[model samples]
Structure formats: C-alpha cells, structure tokens
Target: MIKDKYTYINREISWLQFNARVLQEAEDESVPLIERLRFLGIFSNNLDEFFKVRYATIKRIEEAGKAARSELGGYAASELLEIITQIVIKQQSESLDILNKIHEKLEDENIYIVKEDQIDESQHSFIKNYFIQHVSPALVTIVLSDQVDLPTLKDSAAYLACNMKLLDGKCQYALIEISRTMDRFVVLPKKDNIDYIIMLDDLLRYCLHDIFSIFEYQDITAHMIKITRDGELDFDSDLSKSFIEKISDSVKHRQIGEPIRFVYDKTIDEETLRYFMDKMSIETNDSVIPGGRYHNRRDYMDFPSLGRTDLLYDKISPLPVKGLSLERSIFSTIANKDYLVYTPFHTFSYIVKFLREAALDPKVKSIKITIYRLAQISHVASSLINAAKNGKKVTVAIELQARFDEQANIDYAEQMVSEGINLLFGVRGLKVHSKMCVIEREEEDSIVRYGFISTGNFNESTAKVYTDFTLLTADQRILKDINKVFNFFETNYKIFRYKHIITSPHYTKSRFFKMIDNEIENVKKGKPAFIKIKLNSISSYMMIDKLYEASRAGVKIQMIIRGLCCLVPGVRGMSENIEIISIIDKFLEHTRMLIFCNNDDPKVFISSADWMTRNIENRVEVTCPIYDNDIKQELMDIFEICWNDNVKARILDETQSNIYKKNDLPKVHSQFDTYDYYLKKLQS
Candidate 1:
C-alpha cells in the first residue's frame, strides 16, 4: 500500500469494499433463504451501476491521458481500474459460492431451481406451453453471418448468444433478447411436494428448436450475455434550448452511450466471443466478465413473492406517528407544534395527508414542493392536481434528470402542466434533490407556511423499504429559507442568503467545514468535543480531511456510513479516535444526520445531502437544524441505537475486510430494535 501523510483510501475502491459487505449478507446462512437471494440480487445490481457510472468515469479519465492521481486524491485512474477489476472478480467468485450454498439449502426446503436438462416430462410440457404463450412473441432474435452489423445491445436487458450447427455443416450465430415483459423466474408444476423453479432463459433454451424450427438447425447452444453502457448524460451546450429540453436530449443520448463492460457466460464459444469483440470494437482493456449462464440477476428483486409469504420477511405495518392522525387535518396539527415522521417505522401517509388537507382546506392558498423522484402512481402528484383543480395555487419543482427515472418524471411533469399546475422542471445546471414541501395557509390575515423536510425522496413506494427521517414543522425561519430555495429555482440568477438552513452549491460545504472547525476549537479549549454523522456516502476528500484534522485534534468522531465510505477509521495516531460502522439490514438506512457537541449544547441536523462531492457542490440540497427538544431526543435515540448495533454492523477498517462488530454483550439488531423502540414509544 502506498502510504502518504495526507492521502486516504480511493473512493472507487472503497465503494467496491462497501459492495463486498452487501455480498457478505448473502453468505450469512443465518439470514432467511429468500432474503439471502435478494441480497445477491442487490449486489449484482449495485455492481452493474458501479460499472456503468464510476468505472466508466475512471475509464474516460484514463483514456484522456491526464494525471488523475492527484484528482482522485491518491491513486491514478489506471491503478484504480486494476484494483476495481481484481476486487470485483473476487466478489463475483464469492457470490457464486454463496449461490451454490443457497441452492443446496433450497433443496433441503423442497424447492429446486432446475436447468434445462433437469426438466421432467411434466415440467417440459409446462415450460413449453409457458414459453410459447408468454415468451415467444416478445423474443427478438437476430442472425449473425458477417452480413449485418452487430445490433445495438440494451444496457438494462440481457441477450442469449446462440451458436447453431446447421445440417449443411454451416455455423451461425444468433441473438435472443430476454423479455422484460415476462418474469425472469418461471414456477413449474409441483411434483410430490417438491417445488421447482426455472430461469426464463432456460425455458427459452428448452424451446429453442421450436423458436428456430423454421431455420432447420440441428445442434444449438445458448449462453447469456449482458452489456453495461456509460450512463453519463451528455448535454449539448446549445444556448437556444431550455434546461428541461437539454436534460431531455441528454436522457435520449444516454440510450446509445459507449459500452463499458460486457458480461457473458463462461461456456461461450471463443469464436463467437471474438466476433462480438471485433464487431463492438471492445478492446481487452474494457471489462469482459465471464460468469454463469444467467445474467441480469436484478430481475430477481421482484422474484415472485409467490404466495410463499411464510418464506419471506414478515411484513411490518407502518405505524402512525403518535398523536398524529390522518383523518384529522395535518395542517392543524402542524400549526400547533412541530412533528417528526420517521418513515418505514412511521407511516409515510402524513406527507400525503398534508397534501390532501391542503387540497381541500379553503384556508390553504398555495402548495409548493421540490420533487426528485415520485412513485409510478404517485398520490403526491394526484394530491397536487387536486389542489390545482380546487383553485389553490400549486407549484412543483420537478427534477426531470433523476437517472433511470427521467421518463417517469417527464411524464409526471407533462401531466401536472396540463392540469394547470405550475410545473418548474428544475434549475438550469443543478438537480433539485432536496425533498421539501410547503403549504401556504391564509390564516387570520397572514399567510402561514407549514411543511416538512426529509432525507429521502417523496416516493411512497420506496418509503416502505427505505429508512429516512422527515420533520414536519411550522417554524417560519426554516420555511422562509425554503421559500428562498424555491425562488432560486424560479429566478436562477438571484443570490439568496440563508441563516437557519444549509443550502448546497453555495453553503453546504463551507458551512460543514465551519462546523468541524468549531469542534476543533472546542477540543483546544478543553471542552467536550465530539461529532457524530450518519449518511449514505462519505466520499468527498475535503470532508474526510476535515474529519481527519478533527481526529488529530483529540475530538472524538463516530460515523455510521451506510455506503461508499472512503475514510479508513481506527488508524493509530491518524484516526485512532474515530470509529466507523455500516449497518445493512432489512430497510435501507437513508437518513443523513449530524450531531456536534458544541460544549455540551448539542447541535443536531437532519439533511437531504450526504458528504459526497455531488451532494455538497453539484446538486441542490438542504440541511435543517432540529430545534424541537422532543424531535432532537428522538433523532438522538435512533442514532444511538444504530451506533450500538453489534449485529449487522460491519467495521470499516483499512483492510476493507468487512468484519462484523464483535462484542461480549447481548446481541442487538438495530433495525428490529429500532422498530420495537418506536413501538414502545407509541404504547407509552
């Protein structure tokens, strides 16, 4: 390892290490079988995105021939690429091992995932009928014979590369696109209390002759292949177009982005692979991963919840916030005092209830919100439309550049616009990622604004599985600054100053640095100096350096980073005072919280931004201080529970080994413990 005084771990490599921890979840036999499979699917999906975005970016930097070592903070882009490739290869092998073990365990449970050759006569008939009815019409096959240019492969979908031997001694290659229109797992007829599952690819393999019976191929072989393309949005610097139009154009351009990686079955023919490599102009330097016959395991995320509810995690009903009812007017409750909504634990319906109340309440004059991503059939959008239809002014700042969801956001924007809602696409050069909603009420000759700020999206569908914090407050000081942020989105040229809110692209980084500096000063004064932060990612080198400085200054630091942490904690004399842990549990830990011991007068903040560079300087984000005593205590309680977690919490050390926290105390699983903690609160 290269050692330098100020240098730290490379962010990309650290991200791979974080993903390894996720893969470890699959290897843990104590987890439920289906949950373990879902973890593997998550690992696969995460790696696909890492290749598409981070790996692709580094590849571009390497290709540009610039000295990216300094830009990356320690290692060159070329070196990082090699490191990533090695780490990913190891993790992929581990994933296969875990999958084999899971398969064995599944057999013990009387469920079998069978291949094409293992099918019985009954299964054969069932699969044949299933394929012809469901999979055949959606299958698009292309014959490769040097007469046609290679087809443009989709990044999100997988293809079956077929090698066929005809009766005339001629060899041919063909492609079969896996149909996303159909489910990836096909459940077969049960025999003798034994359940059987077959991959959609194998089902296609079983019926391949029927699919190509008209072509008269005697021998055939099908291998799965998947391509990952660069997902960067390339927007033209055209002055005539609006920002929304540029984002739309960039979204379209992303469909044909350069291929970054090609993953194929290990048993694929060398000749066919070479033909594909030559046609696609893919050099050996590009990632060409060899794997099992099935690719795109992300589809397993939807793996047929299949009436086997007993085999999955018991569904927990999201509880209502204590003393906050959906039937009553949400505005009236907020008008009385500030409230907090902890999601997945507390129902996300309060947000919807707030909007619904605004839609019908005559005293409410206007509603405004900044939306990053909304659900497919969003009640949020419906409520906004209802407000607009009821003659209440509704303004929505909808981000049309939420990656992979750009089309959905664009559709929502158009629908809202047609419904007389004042829809603002987003800022010119920045994504509006902050989740904030404001309702202006015409109460007693003065307009009062009531709303909430969150650390996650306004998406109700995701709220069930994502752990996030949302604060509902009628505090005018914070809402006034929120209004300023909306104004910044509208005007784009006005320079707004905020005192109570930390707005990004201008204030987030500097303000956070100042907070760290304050902690450093407190340490020097012999006062209680400590900092606790919880975020999704901590990849920004500058922020990491600030924390390192604080660690050197004798200020205790505790971090609960759920993903992509670049700082290596517990290094003697470098970061000995700092401890870092990551929790991967049932719900995605998405809340961003920061607590600083300002000489025992603690300051707590809930933010929509992580410590990553993208969140601090490139996107629009907000970090609001928690002022209410009850809410501050609630946030602290949740953070402390996560911090004390020995189960499911992994230490982030320099080795990137993802070692679980070991102690002699009784086991405490944070996610379940947190749910019970809130349940007790409701009872009391």
Candidate 2:
C-alpha cells in the first residue's frame, strides 16, 4: 500500500475528469453520429452546473483564507482552483476539435450547420420572417450606455454583445438576451438534397442591421456571450414567514447571485469586454472564458432531430416485466415475491400502475411518499391527488429545495394541498433525498403495506435516460421502517429507529463503516473477503480512509463509479487490491449498489446515497438490503457486467488522466450487453 501525506485526490478535480469521459464519447467514432452530438451537449451541461455549484463554492473558500483548506480535507482551495481552471481549458480545446470532426462527418451525410454568411437568398427570407413572427416579441434589447444598472444578467442565458458604430464615428454597446422561449435552431429549406440549420445567434446576426436601423448606425457587430452566476440561495431565519415564502424569496435571490463566470466571443473588441465586466464588477480571475461565436452550447441538447432517422440510433421501447402486467394489481403480485424494475430496460409505468391501483382500490386506507425531484407533468402527483379524492388519507413529503427544481416542486405542493392531500415541506435543515413510496391496504382483517424503494428519483422523464433500479416488495420490516421515515418528516421533533434500513444524518455512515469493518475482519481471519460498490461519486474522506484500511487488510475491492471518484486505485501496497473503472455510455449509471462477501454468503444493497459527505451527513437518504434470491442474483450479474466493461470504462489513477481500460479480449460494451441480458431473460 503506497500511503503518502496526500492520500486522496480533490473531489472537484475528479469530477472534471469524469466529465472528460463524457467528452470521450463524443470523440469515439464507433458511437452513433447523432448520439455523439448529444454527448457533447451532456458534457457542456455538466460543466455549466459544475461552475454554478461546485466551482462557485470552491472560489468562495479561496477568497476566505488558507485556513479553509483544512476544512476541505487536503489540498488548498487556491491550488485546487488553479488546477480546475487549467483542466477545463484543456477539455474545452478538446471539445472544439471533436466538434470539428463531427461537422466533417455530418457533411458526408449532406447535413450542414451554417452561419449567417452561408445562407442563401431563399433561406434568408425564411429566417427573417421566422424571427419576426416567433422571436420578436420575446426579444428585449438594453442599450448599455444609458442603463442605470446593467440589467441583471441571467445565469445560463446567452446574449449578443452588440457594438454599433454611429454615422458620427462614435461606438456604443447594446445587449440582447437570446429568446430561450423560442427554439435555438432554425432549419432552413433544403436545396439539392442538402439539409441546412442555422443557430439562433447567427439568425439574429443576419438581421442586426435591421434591428438597429432606427438609430442611424453605420456599422453594427454582435458577438455572443454568457454569464454564469452562483446559484446558492440564502434564507433568513425570520420565523414569521412560512417555508414556502422563504423558498420563493430564495429563488428571487438566485437571480441576482454574484457572477462567477463571464464567457464571451474572443473575436469581440477589447473595449466591449471591459465595458460589460466593469458594469458587472467582475475580476480577472473570475473565469473570463473567451470562446467561439456562440455561447450556451447546452442548447445543442435540443438540436433538431432533422427527421433523418438513419442518422440517429433507433429508440428502444421500454420492455415490460416478465410476469407483471399493467392490468393486474401490483400489490398482490409484490405480496407473492420481491420484483425489481430496471428502467429504460424495464418500463417505468409499473410504478405508476402500482399507485393507480392503490388510488381506486376500496380497501386502501392511506398512502405516503417522499419526493425530492419530480417530473414537470407528474403522473405520480396525479395518482396521489386521485387517492386523496377517493377519501384515502394521502401524505406527501416534498423537498422544495432541490437545486434548479424549486419552482416545479412548489407548484406540485400547492396543487396537491388544494386536492386535500397532506403535504410536508421536508425536514427543517436536511433535504429529504430518499425515493420511496408506501401504500396501506386492508386485507381480510389486517392492514398490509406495499411499497417501492428506489436508487433514483421518481421522475419518469429522467428514468428513460438514467439507468436505475426500483424494488417493489411487501416486506413487513422494511415497509414498517419506511413509515417511520415519513413520520419523521411530518413531525420533525420526533426521532425514529430502524433495524433493517440505513438512513442518513443518523445511522447511514456508521452502518456502512461497520460493514467495511466486517470485511476487514473476514480478511484477517484468512476467509474470502471482497467489496464491490457502484455509485455516482465517492468523495468523503472518512469513507475513503476506511476503504484504505480494508485494502491494507488484504480485502479485494472493485469499484464502478460513474462520476467523481477521489480515491486513487491501484497504488502499490496502499490500494493495490482496489480497481476503479467508470463507464460513460448510452445511459447514465445512476444506481447505487454495494456488495460485500460475507465469508462467501454475499450481502447486497441498493441505495439512494453515494459515499459523499453531503449524502452521508447532510441529506436524508436510504439504503435497503436485497433479500430475495432472484433479485440478489440479478443485481450481482449487472454489477459484474459493468465491472468487466472495457469499451467505455476509464481507469481512475493518481495523475487524474482519463484513460480507457485496454485488453486483448473481445470488446464488451456493458450497456448494450445489459440490454441483451435483460431481453434474453424476457425471452426465457
């Protein structure tokens, strides 16, 4: 085990490395073309959030002092900040190269991403009319020289930094916020079987002269720029206002949060950049990222499908569970045995079907659920409302502080309350992060509870792209404890105990450490000992140290983490037994699974928590055991497949270089293989 003073990599830097793997997907020639483009969008979107949250927090620490570095674990905040900036700059350059290659490939298929100068006469007229009819009303232009306070710039909105040269040989600047209310891509009329699409920015650039014609400007130039602000919200402990009002005020505060980044076109004049920065009070070190002609590459996530089905991968229909049907009562089937639903591979509708049945069943008495993130148009909320309308007591614990999702959750809470459902606005200080639902129904003489515990959110829209596992069971002990969690949410003063479930802010961290200790003891006894964990991240120093102890005790460790793994694997004598690989492919690996070799009688758990500090000590999370024989074997099989993947898996090492695992054996893409594995099970 090679142990040094620096025992772990910084979490923020590790996260950036994970995103580089996503960029690799865009560069891989074997990937489907359109899928590659979408990966680029995913990479860009991930970076945006990293800046808004993680980077912003680190910058704050840097400004505080060197004393804050001790609290950050090992690396100084200033040092980490410099590393992140350098790494992001390199990744951005790589992304530009990948984009150029993708464009060349697109031209081979007769598809073109054109700018304003490339548009023909017919396309020009089409874009002009389209802009006037659809985009004009939403456009708001601020004349920069005359504004009292530079209009509060939005977090992710793109803007055009207009520089107008008047007939008097004087220069002035104006700002136009891109109309996100309208589509960002405008498809033009195809000519000679070639398809052309223009960006929203370019379309505006084409009509710049027309927009400022009233001002008698001789020369007009518009360059794209975007500002990313710190999204953290500060709430006052007034005691007079309700939680709802506090959250609303926080949302308003988010709009005016300090600017953390100012990205603009490099081609813009120095005077223009300085003008905007001065008004926003932005310092030089505050991420003044200069880029291409367009900003907000995240808009590419909605790039038009173009109706060229051949250019994209065929959409796979979510398969039905082998024995469960939508028409049947889900509770009765779950009562027979535990069943697992693997989403996108297995239909997410099974969850909805279970709730719907409970709503209309005459014997059902009450329903309790905890929602952290929800779909925009949620069927889950609708089912709860229907149950409430049917006279069943329904209670919902909604986390109104879910980042970027506060507004939607507040809306759902209000609507659910109006429908006579009992609504709880989470715990006072901790955000409830568990994805669980319980329904109580009377059977003969006793009330029986049936529910689902999941490793992901209840949002159906994300279920299609995020690979997760939901276990539907009628286990008495687990459901009884789930009820306790819901009770804790409703009555914050009350404390609850659990024998089977591991819950955060109380027992989760201690429980996991105990499990790791057991593995260490088993290894000391000269018995078979191994640990396997699959999660989104692993950054908590305490947990990392525990894993290191187990590694030194001769316990073999295998990890399949999809994002932000701070522990350096494969270090001699220190972590030589630990092998870590991350897979970034068609679907996000979001399921949190942990397996321990309990002297050959293995133990497995599916959890909503990762091994991060926030999940263990700051948030409310749940981790449940897999007891059913069939389900345990299924999870083991999935984990093994992911661990063996060489195609998309990247090694996590000390240098933080994201290198794909290479072998001479036949290539195995775990996602495609997992799909095939499930399909075969259905056939059997």
Overall lDDT per candidate, in order of appearance: 0.87, 0.87
Worst 10 residues of 1 by lDDT: 1-10
How many steric overlaps does candidate 2 have?
Answer: 3
Clashing pairs in 2: 1-573, 1-574, 2-574
CA-only RMSD, every prediction: 1.7, 1.6
* lDDT of each residue in 145-254, candidate 2, tens digit only: 74567889988888999988888998888898897888888888899999898888888888887677678878788888888889898898989998988998998888
